[model samples]
Target: MKPIFKLQNRKLIVIFGLFIIAELGIEIGFTFVSARTGFYFVLQFSILMATLFILFLIERSMNRTKQELTKNKQKLQNIFDTLDVAIWSHELSSDTLLITQGIEKLYGYSLEQFYEDKSLWKKVVVPEDMHIIEEREKKLSIGEPITSTYRIVRPDEEHRWILDRGIPIFDAKGNFVDFTSVLFDITHRKESEERYRSLVESLPDMIAVISRGKIDYINPAGFKLVGSSSAAQLIGQPVKAYLPAHVLEQIENEREEKKTFEFMLNRLDGKRIDVEMSAMPILYGGRSAHQVVVRDITQRKKAERTIQFMAYHDSLTELPNRYRFKQHLSRILNSEGDRTVAVMFLDLDRFKIINDTKGHTVGDQLLQKVSQRLQNTVGDEGMVSRQGGDEFIICMEDISKEKAAEVAQRLLDVFTSPIAIDNQEYFVTPSIGIGIYPEDGTDEETLIKHADTAMYLAKERGKNNFQFYSPELLDVSSRKMELEGGLRKALDNQEMILHYQPQVELETGKLVGVEALIRWLHPQNGLIPPAQFIPLAEETGLIVPLGKWVLRQACEQNKAWQDAGFPAIPISVNISVRQMDDEHFLGSVTEALEKTGLAPRYLDLEITESIMQNIERSTDILSRLKELGVRLSMDDFGTGYSSLSYLKHLPIDSIKIDKSFIDDINHPSNQGLMVKSIVDMGRNLNLALIAEGIEKEEQVSFLKRNSCAIGQGYYFSAPVTAEVMRKFLAEGFVSV
Candidate 1:
């Protein structure tokens, strides 16, 4: 297309030329115009047209350049609006503000509003930060670059943190034109700083930061630990002042390797404490430094020491226990002190009886006093240690045979003085056994074993005296160990059997019941009686499982007899106190009856009178048995702590008069009177009275006279096999 400016210029040229020509023509025709006048008009008109067209071309080019500039400016603004940061420019002369769309997103205002209100930036500055903004504005006016962090209150009344960086713009003559600023929302960053500061301040453990070998930061807790009232007191001090010598040397490792360590800290107040610490490299004040965390471990250290002590020492007596004692003895024997050193093993005589009769609390008090006396008697003479239970050991150094005997005698003399405990006076004596080094045995284990054996011998020889261990005692010790091993294998070896003895009614001479007796038929030792292994079982806690086996066998045999069309007589199974105390004793009994298909009534549990010693526990256990429809009998009545007071509280169906009273039936004494009284007691309680050890017919007659109905003794029949009992049942009688 031709230029519109060109077309207009061409028309103006044509008109101007035509007008001039007409003017010339008119002049010639009328001879009224001169040549100078026409020439001047044409030349002036040509000059005017040339100047006008040049102005039109220049105006058109300027308009096109302005449109291109507008398009580029809009594109730049769109790019700036998408940015998260706010960008703005201010004209110095007019105070006019030009801002991107991001300004509205930041301040909740439109760009037009910012332009209309020149003071919008100043108004948004929070009151507290207004001075900072004003100071930065002054910097901008001075053509200086400035950066600042300040709080701004948005139009919606929300406060935000902003980091503003502004650079000054200058004209050609160095006059300030305007300042451009970029603002980044730093609200989240500021909040995170506050939270981090709060956590560091509130920590219980001390935290510190070290920079350039100086303490730059410390938490409040760290200040208190160092006996300082404020961080100012410790900051800028050499880090070595607070750290231990060794830990100070390890600081480099902590920084480079992130090492954690423990040290004994030296406080400013001249006190020492245990501390655990960790250090890692971190940025502090824009410089690489060490950040350390420390924790006070003084109490934890004390607890650790306490646990260590308890592990090796007896808690009750506060004396070195078996483990610690062995350690000391082993060390002494391993060294050169072997010639004259003596190891003495001591035990309190009949301590279990004291515990059971006087109650464990009193027994504990008695043991404490005994331990004190032992300690006093052996003061500076040697070390005394407890070997658990009622047993104790004394190691005497540099003592000859006679001196060792003297020490043992001194120990015995200490126990002669009765000690009072719990408002009651009790006498406790120690049985001491001395095993002299190089004489009794060599090593610690040997010496300790010999001493223990001698202690047992002393007890056998009527306790309260000390005796030296001899080679002869070793034989007995070996036999006892061998017996224990055999007993452990008895159950698995099928070497143990239950023999049932008939219990006959004195009134009708008819068999009424049978008591199950456990006998060990050893492969080589022949028959072993209850007197031998029963006590061992009680001591070793084997009685529980052994008694359970007895119950099972007795229940099965009695059930078999009843199923064979014989009279169902209750078979009594003897339960040791150990079995009664076992947690699963009832469950074992129930399982036995269930497996045997025996009626609960036909299974009788016979407990000794000692069960009444712990009457509360016995009551609870016996009541559970009663609920199972079983009968309970107190075996060996009139023995132990068989107080009639406790007897009335027991859940028993029968009371078995002990053999001792029945054995005295023919004596010319009041023996029958005691039996009759027990019989009368049983009658009053509606309990059956059975006599034990009725070996004579006169004893049976005496029991009949005393109204005791059931009698079991050798006169009827000794403990026999189940088949023999079955034969007796078939005959419906027993023969001596």
Candidate 2:
């Protein structure tokens, strides 16, 4: 407005100068022509012409200036209407207010309404925001520029956030006169800010903003995560106080980019927690900063560690498993420099028998106790691990065969003192086999295999002993494996047959019963002895099916002999410990008798004294057999460590003196005393007595003198096929 005023002033000055020039020209012309004519007449005409010319020029210039002012005012109005803002001014002198049409859009009011009510702008302000308008007016009155934000409610009841920027207009003397202001609507921006604030505040994870080196802002979760009671305790605190120095350096180095890291957070409570923090650059309060989101992962980390431990350790024994043992052995083999490393495979002898008889609960408890003792004995000298079930493997580095033997002896000695379980003491022993590195083989698998083979050898050599790997053991192991493979297929091929040995009445020299024995007629190996493959079958768990086949065959054969018009007599079949431990043993016997139509009294079931280890269960089984009307006999009596106190409780009808005692009767070491004692006991108990392995007449004579009436040995007839035994039965008697 001042520039336009100055331009008008300049134009007015030009007009005055032009009038003066015109007056001067007229006066000079009159002065030159005054001498030739009448001076007064010429002067009057010149004055009139000069006056007309001045009026014409003044009209044109004034009209051009008015057009330009009108054009400028229209341009200013267009600008105000095009923008999303309202431009207005207050006139102090007339107390009048003027505004453009833009006010209608900003405040939802028309120009006429504002003019009718001069205080309409103040009335539209929300009650809570009226102070903003008052403050703006006070600042403007003091000749100051003011920028303020306030809320307003329009006539339509719509609320809006407004930004008012006003500059005070003053006179040349600096007295405040009026003010001009621009009004803008910022409702969308304010709503967005509120939404962002709510989102940050409601998050479960800690959200923090770091500016410079200090914490500029922290959410509620952030305060809780750091164990701070209030925001004041964290805001403006150095981030380094909570984050380690190295972590802070890493954050600083990656400040411009997004990064995630796992670190230990130092809480205000002097405790540390595992946390995962993700940081990224953001603008906060119009300055560059980092926004970090932190999550606690302590529980997840602990769970991961537990899973790792379970992968390599046994659950029940809490010892390293087979995989972990192999890994350790491989590491030692790879790192050692010609040092002897020993891998000893230890198997608890008779564990299956104990487990089957005593219940798996006691077996599990016993295993745990054994593993603990093994570890204590091995100490730091080696690594002891469970190879599943009752098997354990130990790996020792920098050890010789002699040292390994000593270690194995120590392990065996640990079980010397009975393990007390359920208030009962049990003596469990181990069969240990040691295979040395580079001596047995160069690799883990080979060493473990050789050690396993040697362990089987120890069991064969009589359990509760240790054996080192030798080349001869491999041949024995290979042969044993071959026999096991053949044994599995023997029953399927019908290569298995039963042979009967005559059980003679010593007084009459007459056949009273026959003991049935199983033999394998291998196609390639001819007849395989039972001793070579029976243990293999038992160990491989093939005995369950094989024993079933034997029972069926023996029952069927005895019934066939009876159908053939032979003398009626009980046929005895040997039952293994494995068979007795079988839950279906009773069922198998019942099925055999039912299928073969063999009378229960004609079938005699012979059980070894070894079954007495589980005396209560043995008594139950014998009582059930007695209830079936079958004859029960204790085979190999006086050979096993059966308790005499429990023997009377069994429902057995007879006791067979073991062949070992019978073979030793002729010895002079008072060995006959043992047989005499067994015969006397059997008679006193009213149980029939039988002497096995009677190869000489003197042995029979000695047995008959002791009143042991029944005897089965080569002295009468060796075990023979069904036809040969039938011929012997036909003869019906043998000379004593």
lDDT of 2 at 4: 62
Clashing pairs in 2: none
TM-score of each prediction = 0.64, 0.64
Instruction: Estimate the Cα RMSD of every predicted model relative to the unseen true structure.
Output: 11.1, 11.6
In model 1, where is the ten-residue run with the lowest total lDDT? 1-10
Question: What TM-score, to 2 decimals, does candidate 1 have?
Answer: 0.64
lDDT for model 2 comes to 0.86
Which ranges in model 2 have alpha carbons more than 4 Å from their true place? Answer: 1-83, 118-146, 155-157, 166-176, 315-318, 349-369, 417-428, 484-493, 498-519, 523-736
Clashes of 1: 0
lDDT of each: 0.83, 0.86
Q: Which ten residues in a row are the worst by lDDT in model 2?
A: 350-359
